[model samples]
Target: MARTGRRPGLGGTRERILAAARSDFGKAGYEGTTIRGIAAQAKVDPALVMHYFESKDGVFRAAMQFPVDPAEFIPRLLAPGLDGLGERLVRFFVETWDSPAGSPFLGLIRSVVGNEDAAAQLREFVTREVLGRLARALELDQPQLRAALVASQLVGLAMLRYVVRVEPVASASTDELAAWLGPTLQRYLTDPRVTKVNRRSRRRR
Candidate 1:
């Protein structure tokens, strides 16, 4: 009789799942991809997928080769209660990209430049995991706008410093970048001026 349980010696099952997951995520994006779909593509049991990755986010992180788990990292960044968060955020961002672990992130950014699917996936990840979470943490009005503003700053900085390799930004030390960007981030997160601007813009409409 044939065996009815999990296949023994599943040597490449994990790798297969990861490959399938990457494909699915690239095509369907974070919100559209599902564990069952990934398992189907991988030719593995859903149970096996869960056993290996535990959850969809786990699979995403593994497949993407994320350097740090945002779920944990975001909370830690928030632990200091909003004081100097901008500097801390900038410091962390520069340090992470400077390290070997940032290769995957750099690859994703490069892909986003030319690939719509890659761009969508990145937008979703940033909206849901990064911007959305930060907005929620702030517990203030116009969360979406505030988050977008903050993202704009960081994204431009990243493009200039890493992709374009432009002037002083590219050569600047992490400390300098943090010092320059931190206050801006802090303002976006906590300043009443941001809300005032939004209100004024709305009044014009």
Candidate 2:
């Protein structure tokens, strides 16, 4: 008699799968990456990947584990109402990135800068998971556009402060950054000017 199939309690298989997934994702993006491809690279059966991670999205989330749980925080942020949301968002962003927990986010931004596929994947993920939720919660007009505007600001801030490490921005304290960016974010979130701009653009079209 012999043991057929993978050995029980084998170590490294999970890590190997994750590594393969990360590489594949970096190269192919989420839509291009496949379970079979990841399993092949990891030298494991597709079933094994499903067994450990459940699905592609699960694997992606595990591979790119964000320090904060969006489910927990998004609600909390919304709970306080829209008042001061801009400052709150800025504070949260800088504080999170300033902490050790921000490593994954930093890595993500770096990956996005060099890889178009990675950038697309990030855009999809942020829009779908983060900004989309915020926009819907606010019940604002032109939610998608509003969300995109917010994302642009935050992403730009992240690039300067963390990835590029630009002077002043990179060296600034979280409170300083929050104060500087808060009003702008607040405007993006609630200002009627956004609606006016949209109307003007529509008239031009």
Candidate 3:
């Protein structure tokens, strides 16, 4: 069955597509994600993705409403090498959340009740841009899994501190918190699993 096209310039439809793009790109990253996938996620015809975004790159650029350009920052961050990547990353994240710019994140989380779209945007962005970049740089055996584990810590911290407003985890100083969390992320980025854990996990999936 043909999917009917919405009227051109339909109110809220473009926003819906953009939000869906954010979610898809965040989850799959630019290379792994697709326009047709985004269209399906948006509940629109694939033509509409091209109509609104022109191309996959266009969709990616627009979908990334990040506070900073992840591409530029990722390079700069990596240039410093892996010695203190975890600490540097955590410090940056905590600083961003503590700044006025962090307001958008809080607002997004606050508004996320029955609204997973915004959550997806946040999740995917961190997953694709931050974790993905860091993982690849490590050249670990299971880089993606490692990065994902690290992302869980960072995202969990964000949710606790900014969203759920959990007491000590929320109020603790960034350096103090980073000191505790950085090493865990470092392990995920560098740890080598001698067992078939990585291969076994793939088979299970």
Alpha-carbon lDDT of model 1: 0.82
lDDT of 1 by residue, 155-196 (tens): 899889988999899999999999899999989888877887
User: Which parts of model 2 are misplaced by more than 4 Å?
Assistant: 1-10, 20-56, 65-67, 198-205
Give the alpha carbon lDDT tens digit for every residue of 20-72 in model 3: 87777666756678888888888999897898767775566455434445666
Question: 100-176 in candidate 2: lDDT tens per residue?
Answer: 76777877766777877667766766676787788889898877777788778988999888777899998998789
Give the range where candidate 3 is weakest over 10 consecutive residues by summed lDDT.
1-10
lDDT (Cα) of model 2: 0.78
TM-score of 2: 0.75
Scanning candidate 2 in windows of ten residues, the lowest lDDT window is 1-10
Best candidate according to TM-score: 1
Number of clashing residue pairs in every model?
A: 0, 0, 1
Best by lDDT: 1
In model 3, the runs with Cα more than 4 Å from the true position are 1-64, 110-113, 116-127, 194-205
Could you tell me which residue pairs clash in candidate 1? none
C-alpha TM-score for every candidate: 0.85, 0.75, 0.63
Q: How do the candidates rank by TM-score, highest first?
A: 1, 2, 3
